[model samples]
Target: MFHLLDIKKHDDGISFDQTVDVKAQLLARDPDIIDVDSVHVVGNISFDSGLYLLNYDLTYRLVLPSSRSMEPVAFDNQLFISEVFIEEQDVASKKELVEDDLVLILEGDSVNLEDSVVDNILLNIPLRVLTEAELENEDLPSGESWSVLTEDQYQALQEEKKVENNPFSALNGLFED
Candidate 1:
């Protein structure tokens, strides 16, 4: 839940501060998240010409489970803002409302600010994810599961496919016919 503020009419430029609640939502979505410490999000955002621009910095830490212990991972980066736009369009047949509607557009360097948040979260994710020892040992009921194939397993599968579909084998069949 990223805070959006000061979205009102002002004679001068509008100013607002916000704190994005990414960590809490992420953990809630994935209970396996053991720790999410020191997540920092800093950015400057502005709206102009029906668009929003955001430049930002992100830093965070993630903990992943291993066979013996949890592995700590860190991420730090800067991102540019690109585009932010309003999501409203007037219908041809509908009567115009008394109050004027304001739409915000986001693009270019400002768009990077939004992308930075998502990118940082993805970067923090473990390429090889595992559960803690306690969860691994527990006998849980059957449900949907997701896992990554190891390098060796993927290579072996590819090799097996190659042998089954060799071009030379097809040539031999053609000659026999």
Candidate 2:
């Protein structure tokens, strides 16, 4: 947390470079995350034009279950974020300034960087994640009566089904006679 009063007093702004352990907090928010490394945040908060601007670069390693398989996979992430912080009373007047930017309305006298870090981490989670071996293997999973197929394979199968199930297919012999 960055105290607004302290930052506003300094012309150059307040800079922060630290490692934060948010594993318990993150796991509480999202049960899907298997584990996470300590988060590194390096940036400064500058007060300008009646607003506090936050700029930071965050790095962390997150472990999550694979999309195809349930095995845990580690993902390293580096992200840059710039956000505007507005006080509750100023939100209505400063809506235009924040419309085109990422902004957070401050509920107190300090800025919650941890919450921002957590939110961004959740947003950055990939839709699909595969293990190293899974990437190398070309085979899709299969069961006794059902099998996963590529898009092209599925399209071709659908075409074959259309031809096979055509009601007019049975009338072809009558027309030939």
Candidate 3:
């Protein structure tokens, strides 16, 4: 279960804690997703120095029996306390909720950390759910292959290859004494 606590008013700021059932929420919201095994979430919200910070960590496992080409997705990530800002108005009305800023920070090795950590676990959801057989089958070419090079390394290699094959190399050789 995944839960988010509502912000409570305090002299300097607000603080709260909550736990939510993610699988049930997802199932209720979107019937297309099925076979959710379990979900666990824990976090806290605190306000300080005119800023509101929400820190949360989550771990979940899902079953995608419908998918035929991919693996069943499981994930874990942490949301760090980063920044906080306030929005004076929302699309619904002109009234403001709080006077402080709200900022969220997320750090992890998996993709969609920002979404999971900031977006309240909505964006981290797998686009396509897969079953056990789908996950085990090696013949399926569904997901992207992992890469080894950093951006800098890739750029450097490209530059080196270009210089080695440059057409001007022939001109330089012709001019050689």
Candidate 4:
């Protein structure tokens, strides 16, 4: 946590560059996270016109279960984020700033980088995680009585079924005379 007063006093900004290991904290929040590397955050926080601006680059590696195969998949994530923060009491007064940008309301007198990094990490988790092998494989999984079908394949199958079940096919030319 960085004190707002300390940062506010700096004319330029307070720069931070460090690697923090929040593996335990991350695992506690998400059981699906199989592994996590130390997070590297490099950024600056500056105060300007009653608003605190935070700009940072975050890099980390995460191992998670594959969406389809449930196998562990490693993801190397790099993100650049910029956010505006306002003191809780000054929210009403800084309404214009809030309206102009996505402002984070400070509950206390400090900024918590770990919390922000963790939140962003979770939010950025890919919905579909696939390994190299999975990406190369085109065959869909199948079982004894069930099989996965692509959207186009399913639509074609439905049309074929409708045509086979229709009873008016034999009388199609009867009305031509």
Name the best candidate (by TM-score). 4
For residues 4-40, what per-residue lDDT tens digits would candidate 2 score against the true structure? 8998999999999999888888999999999999699
Count clashing residue pairs per candidate: 26, 0, 14, 0
Give the per-residue lDDT of model 4 (tens digit) for 92-143.
Answer: 9978777876798888899888888888899899988988898999777899
Instruction: Estimate, for each residue in 54-123, the C-alpha lDDT of model 3 and write its tens digit.
Output: 4555555555434444444444444343334322223123223332222322222112223343244455
* Candidate 3 similarity to native, TM-score: 0.41
lDDT of model 3 at position 145: 72
Candidate 4's C-alpha runs over 4 A off are 96-101, 165-177
lDDT on C-alpha atoms for all candidate structures: 0.47, 0.89, 0.45, 0.90
Give candidates' CA RMSD values in order.
Answer: 10.5, 2.7, 10.6, 2.6
Query: Model 1 off-target regions past 4 Å?
Result: 1-22, 67-83, 87-124, 129-177
Q: Compute each candidate's TM-score over C-alphas.
A: 0.43, 0.86, 0.41, 0.87
Error of 3 at 64 (Å): 2.6
Ranking by lDDT: 4, 2, 1, 3
How much lDDT does candidate 2 score?
Answer: 0.89
Ranked by TM-score, top first: 4, 2, 1, 3
Better of 1 and 2 by TM-score: 2
Candidate 1, 43-79: lDDT as tens digits: 5555444333444555556654543235543333333
